[model samples]
Target: MWCLLPTPLCLISVFLLLQAPVAEVFLYVVYKQNSTCMDFRALSACFGPPVPREGLRGYLTEAAPANACQPIGSPPASSNSSEVFIALIRRSGCPFGVKVLHAQQAGYKAAIVHNVNAEQLVSMVADDKEIRQQIAIQSVFMGKSASKHLKRASRYEKGQFWSHLLKYSAYIVIPYVIQEFGFMINVVVCTITLVVCARWYKKGQKITVCTFKRGDKYDTCVICMAEYEDGDQLKILPCSHAWNTHTQILV
Candidate 1:
């Protein structure tokens, strides 16, 4: 096939796509009950070496209650589901690896852990190589706000799954779109500041050195707030701010 686009342009496009902001991840839970769909956005993605890498998207299930006090590495009965399962569980009462591996052994497609101590989201990490390798499912963490809603939805209300269907989909960006927006704002502010500084420099405003004279009523340097005695040398900034030579070092 003959190439239509320029080689450099194609390369740049591929590079840009590959260089997605690493810190940001996408997580969405769609819980459907009869006719209502409750959507939740996960706080952050899990730690290193997410299994399969393509990411997880399918029906979600409660591997256990948000506060299940179970033995470490023990797989619970809730993990037995015929559907592609995304397990939602608390981040305590066991090693994160234990809960995840147990869920994986019982056929969970992914795991969403909720933080118990704090409201902010965190990336779940396993220290053991052996345990990390056993994980063959994607995983992530959610904050308190979303987890509260999720725990309620994971139950059977009045003998039926409160939510008739549970869906879990992972993403790399856009769900954490605020990070990108914040980065952009920082860049724009920096750019605008640089432009303004350059324009000010171009205008050639000169800084003047003011020598203190005897009987001068303005005896205090505004920047350092030091009393200016006779013969004190001051640098008057273009913006009308002034400081004494002794205070210039601090500036």
Candidate 2:
């Protein structure tokens, strides 16, 4: 069990190794208006039909009710579902599958749900198996940053600040660090533990004491001038000296 002691760095590494990563495919959506276009990154749903590798090209549309939790009436003026359209919905009020189903009923080809806050990416899951089976179109979760860019692109203006690469660097880098340097980290931790045990062992060395024999060559304690008896205890030193002192040197 001595070898089981983990250093601070090892604890951190193990914690990272045990983390559950949200599984999703990363893809970018290109929003175009007139002659200008800008690309925004999004995370694909873990459930539902996958977005095609060639990508889904559609007109971006905001749902009539915004949440898309209920039956939607029609596509807004900015969108035309006749030529494939993708619905933009907010993150609350109902299950993600319900929102996507409402968008599907309104003739949208796909749906993109944006979080209320600029936060970590989350995997989208349907509320039940029936909802999962009914979803035929692809849906994705959009971060607030990307949603903000989409709003800007709607007005045909490019965003000035895009720092999603920095915002999400920790999630990408931690897993990579654990995968690449995990063995070396274990070796370093074991080495430190061994070195600590060595120092403790050296400091905790025990001096052995035994019963004195009456007829030994030296039969007296040099410090206290006490005679040795067969049953008397003697303290043995490293220099081959034995003493039978009743107080200090005797055990």
Candidate 3:
């Protein structure tokens, strides 16, 4: 004779089986003090700390330290600050204040805001009323190309460049290509079906032919004040107005 195990005992055994490995691994790492697992000190050393810089005329007053770097949001020397600001407006969502605060929290000393269309450099004043110790603000005008290069360089240092590439390739680029190929195949099948349907419809349709005399006066189109010619197709808009191709005007 065989004995039946209780339901609760089976559940507890499964749960323990699943959780035991993870707990054992965690405790083993903890006891061994292994550097491979989630070490804040090691990760911080890899990225390094932010370099501190004084805000001077909307630019960094000094260079970054050997291990750290700062983001300089300014136009190139040859271009004016206004142009940089305009460019910033186009590429970056807003004037950069909101992102500046986030960057400050991440240890950025100053944000060099630039114009995309002008040459004069301007400084962004942080709202001192709400300023926190982590917040630092600065601005400058750098050309669009220079600004892009600076951003890329910064990402490269933080190991974000490759990570971003991997994310895009996995989620965006590959999926987009697959979707485009699928759409092309679907379009080809639809075209063939449409051709077959059109041929069948023509065989059963009763075609009508009409002739119009030249110089037959018709109502002039109000939009362009042009007389409709023969063989011209007319469309009656939803507003109860009729117009021909030559006389139709888009608002």
Query: For each candidate, what is the lDDT?
Result: 0.56, 0.63, 0.31
lDDT of 2 by residue, 127-208 (tens): 6888888888888887888777565543332322211111224664576568659978889999999999998777445435
Candidate 2 vs. true structure, TM-score? 0.52
**For candidate 1, what is the TM-score?**
0.54
User: Would you list the rank order by lDDT, best first?
Assistant: 2, 1, 3
Superposition-based RMSD of candidate 2 using all C-alpha atoms, in angstroms: 14.5
Off by over 4 Å in 1: 1-19, 47-60, 64-82, 158-182, 195-251
Can you give the lDDT of residue 44 in candidate 1? 38
**What residue pairs clash in candidate 1, if any at all?**
26-171
| Candidate 3 C-alpha lDDT tens digits along 155-228 | 23222111100111243245546876999999999999999999978753533323223554435565777766
Preferred candidate (lDDT higher): 2 or 3? 2
Worst 10 residues of 2 by lDDT: 7-16
TM-score for each model: 0.54, 0.52, 0.22
Give candidate 2 misplaced runs (Cα > 4 Å).
1-22, 33-37, 76-82, 155-251
- lDDT leader: 2
